[model samples]
Target: MTTLPAPLVWTFDGPFERCLADIEDTLRRAIVMVGDVSRVAMLIDLSLPALKQRVDAGEALQPAWGRFLERMARYGLPASPRVRHLRGAGPLATLVIAYRN
Candidate 1:
């Protein structure tokens, strides 16, 4: 398989909504640096239950995620990409964006 370029990594913390805002801000900044974005790898550091709790508590920050995904879809990336959960010693969440160029 062809290897994609190293992604632009973005770390997020604090309240879920705040974190999502950070992601959105970073994504906007990244566009300036990397041009158009095609794919993104979202790494959630929290476990499934922890994530569920955030979602149940209206803290999943779906709006930010939705906006990001919507942007990706406009770039021709599939609306439903394969998602995987990984455990790693990193920030609470990380968004790795790959530029289309």
Candidate 2:
């Protein structure tokens, strides 16, 4: 019989340490705000410009993609204390995580 807060969204511009840090921070904050009854929805994808820029900056998509998936594996993406990846967007390597805490 209570209304929940609106969903929190975190967008990553690049797959850099700083950007990833921001995402972790935001996700944590959302969990805290919602507590054991929080509902969350996340959409992480590679923008065209961002994708091209990283490649131009000498960042390969495979390695970067691997880095992301590796982090998910380490943190247990589909489990507690981690974001749950709901659906596969495409070969574009989008990570859309949704869950309720």
Worst 10 residues of 1 by lDDT: 39-48
Off by over 4 Å in 2: 1-5, 62-64, 73-101
Candidate 2, residue 75: the lDDT equals 39
Residue range 35-83, candidate 1, lDDT tens digits: 4444443333433454555677777556767775675455443234334
Pick the TM-score winner.
1
Each model's TM-score?
Answer: 0.53, 0.51
Which candidate's lDDT is highest?
1
In model 1, the runs with Cα more than 4 Å from the true position are 1-5, 37-83, 87-90
Could you give candidate 2's per-residue lDDT for residues 15-80 as a string of tens digits?
554455566566556555655423545556545655566578876656545565566445333443
**How far is 20's C-alpha from truth in model 1 (Å)?**
0.4
